[model samples]
Target: MDTFKKVTAIRGMNDVLPQASGRWERLEQHVRDWLRSYGYANLRTPVLEHTRLFTRGIGEVTDIVEKEMYTFTDALNGESLTLRPEFTAGTVRAAIEHNLLYDAPRRVYALGPVFRHERPQRGRYRQFHQVSVEALGFAGPDVDAEQILMLARLWKILGLKDIRLELNSLGAGEERAAHRAALIAYLEQHKDILDEDGLRRMYANPLRVLDTKNPALQEMAAGAPRLLDFLGEASRAHLDGVRARLDDAGIAYTINPRLVRGLDYYNLTVFEWVTDRLGAQGTVCGGGRYDGLIELVGGKPAPAVGFAIGMERLLDLWEQSKDEVVGQAVDVYVLHQGDAAARRALQLGEQLRDAGLDVIVHAGAASFKSQMKRADASRAAYAVILGDDELARGVASVKCLGDGSQQAVGFDALAGTLVDALSADGDAGMPEPSAAPPV
Candidate 1:
């Protein structure tokens, strides 16, 4: 008997099986299309970077840096590294490292997995994917509004509704510093009510304490000095500018005073697209202007703003809002019996694929009814059966799975016949077939 223990996927990291991967792919394609429409190019960064890159860029006191980062020491070099907790820091690092902004400000985006050591829940995972979009070296509220509008357009394209926008401005450094001083004093007065987490972060990151979810401290947090009250004129103007643009575009938003994003780098104009459906994880997407992050990440001083969409959360909402089934996997499923018929089936599949059709040729020995059942299970639009008699006659028995219609087409005319039939049914224009030949 086999005695070895079976291994399973690590906790908090789940595999995307075929059943659900289709939805993931569809969402990803929509994201790519939406980003490209705004001229945002793709930017990919390595998953690992030096530990200080995050510690300094994301802030030493932020929860992501202090608690959630997956950090390790490299045995070869005796240096510490971390799987990126978020994309902003790494995107900025890449922009500076490659001098991408030397000629002009760039709009680039990254899509990939991010790592964090956190308890997994529905729509939240230790290994989750993100579509992070950044506009580097652009220093105006217009760009900020543009990013917000871009998100609105995407939601419309995705047919997602009831996801409202909440906006806030962290203001510039001096303004926030003033707010921070006042906040710390307020928290000091309420130290008796501060929970362990709030007390620990009260001084180092008092702004975050206001964001605490502790039910006991809700009243105290609400009573703390609002950051908006302390905004300087320039900071207020920037916020006003963004609001004006959003108004011009007919976008509705609320100025959430406590919407300070959980990052040290964010200053000025932070926003989140939140939904009520996801329960505790309400924020589907969040980002803000981090004007100083470029310099913080070892780049020359430059202004930048960006946002990240948690794919898992976005997908969860997408599944709830949309009901359209994912398209059939293949345009045609070829089934055959007997050696000669199987060979002909393979050849016919290749011919159909050459004319821009997805073809899956059945393999192994199975009865005609069994093959038909397999073809139906594949969700193919049409099934081409090549029995020995049909192979001898140099024709195929084409059956439409959708309408239960069948026709006999000669080998030379099979591709054109199917194409014409599919086009008539409004299912033509199939994507290029896979490079690997049908098995």
Candidate 2:
């Protein structure tokens, strides 16, 4: 026999197996409902896009472009392509390509996997899902504040706690330019305190240096020039407007002058929802206004703001804070012995399904004891047992998995019986099966 090597999933890429997939499904449903409530429609873009999109849209100097992106040349066309490191760049590109803003400003959201070549750690993955929401073509601070308020509602919906919001402004091009000049000068003065990463990004992307996680540079970065100070009159008014709305909404937030997001496109109104529950990977979601990105991505200049929540991190926080349990796979499990009974069981399963109850018929040969064990393990509310005698009498023994009460339910009455039993249970603790009249 020839030996074969086992193939495994790539590092940092993970499978959402059945046991954990229930939680993912629940989280996704909550996200969909939340986005819908805010009038944000869904927009989907492909996982792969032209590499120039991110380079031009996200800024060539940002870490996503310089280091994390999974870039490759197409085998057939020889054109450079990349797996999207984030959704905003692709969202803007799609909007421009499709003339999404020709009519009016659009509020759109995307939920899907994003690829990045980063080391996997707690709550961070190479292939991770993001809930991205973008409000394109909207100006003024109201839309920005609206997005922030939307996030606050989501945290409440998810029952997540201990997560605080931090806000900052990057100002406009000239304002950031002034801040950049002053920041570079400050960094140059503290060159000895800067790490290799900080020194490399010092002049090319000086703002990122302040956002560094390096403890050695934290003190120096904190002391550097604040972007809020460099804000011009318009920028100041814009930040103040967002703050006013947030204050009115009673959403508490901090003005962290050093909260420059990792992306190069953000110019104003950057914020992050941070939590200590997930250790050093504390940021569960972050986004900011990227007013120049639409124009840079070959569209008419449109002001836009958006945010992306890391599903993994958010799910982690949700699990920590909520005591939710995954419900049973099926409402009823059907088991039968003998060929005629097996045939009847299949029909019964479909009939129960038609009546709007989830039903699974036991497959292949199995003893009653064996099938009952499987039914109990399935956590079904009731088990419909059909053997030769029960099938001959045109009735099934309905055993309540909860309290072991068994009743004879005729074939015509089985679906109605289970529905009533399930409705009475109401997804609270399962109650004992009520007595059924003689068939």
Candidate 3:
């Protein structure tokens, strides 16, 4: 047989090792609890879907469809599919296919991995995770304002600072079309200054060209027709409504007229929560009202608004905040010597566990000194030591790792005593396992 070769994770698709998992868990739980508080149920859709779902939803002319989709055809049936680049398109597809909105207007959330074919650097990844929140069948700006406030609350929970919000309105279809014509005319005049990317998107997606990072094109883009100036009465009122609600709640925001959603679907209100902390990729969350998407996806006309947060980037800020996302302190590490005592240690371990303590039964044979060293390494509050002599007397020695005090007690009373000591602060007896440390 040919020699087997070592395989590794594909580039930009990373493995979540033990050390990083604790932070992920903490962030995910916070999202779940926060979503539930707003009565948003969880919805899960497949990661792989028909390629049309995105091309039709995210806009064929956009960078996501034109340059960044991981598309493939099934070898068996020859159907085209692509790893979902974002959650909104797929969520709307599911809602329309299953008639999920028939019962009532729904607020739902989803958390999962999404893929894109792009250079992975710093916080950007080819395979990344997002926490997507969507509210369907409601057309007013009230929900839009609520979603923005909810994000402000999250910053408080994470102790995130130096974050700011940029708000804009894309207007209804007709107004956007007029502005599109005006913007194209302006871009054509400055075609000499436009770079390759800007020229490509000028007529195809004129709005994206406004946000380009090219220092040379910045002034030229700034002189282009402003979309906010083109907003009609209805579009202007909708944005004003959202602004009024945000002001009532005392949330500070800046109105960035150039903050346009390049996709065909987004309309009315769009917003982005940004921070200087993440360097070039500073948009931590972004979304807007996509009222026409449900209809495009084959459902009765339903209005929807939502946003997604990039987990990797947010976790980067979480680390910056110095929040302790690791598991709670270890309660006990059980150490025993001799085969007989090891056998008895198993039972004693269960008894301690039943009394509501975290007990890790030390395995294999090791010297007393080695066992004590491992126990201290565990960072546990106590070390329960069982030896051949202690087994013979039906007693065990417990050492308070915190104070280095040792006491001998009958095996029968050991569990209760440890439980009392650890539970003094009223923590659960059978507390959930904390993040596992590396072996």
* Highest TM-score model number: 1
Total backbone clashes of candidate 3, pairs 3 or more residues apart or in separate chains: 1
| Candidate 1 segments whose C-alpha is farther than 4 A from its true place | 262-264, 425-439
Better of 1 and 3 by TM-score: 1
Candidate 2 has a TM-score of 0.94
lDDT of 2 by residue, 95-162 (tens): 99999999999999999999988889998889999999999999899999999998999999988889
lDDT of 2 at 64: 83
Ranking of candidates on TM-score, top first: 1, 2, 3
Per-residue lDDT for 264-288 in model 3, tens only? Answer: 7789999999999998899999989
CA lDDT, every model vs. true structure: 0.89, 0.88, 0.88
The parts of candidate 3 lying over 4 Å away from their true place are 1-4, 327-330, 348-359, 389-400, 403-439
For candidate 3, the TM-score is 0.89
Q: Model 1 scores what on Cα lDDT?
A: 0.89
Give the CA lDDT, 0 to 100, for residue 410 in model 3.
74
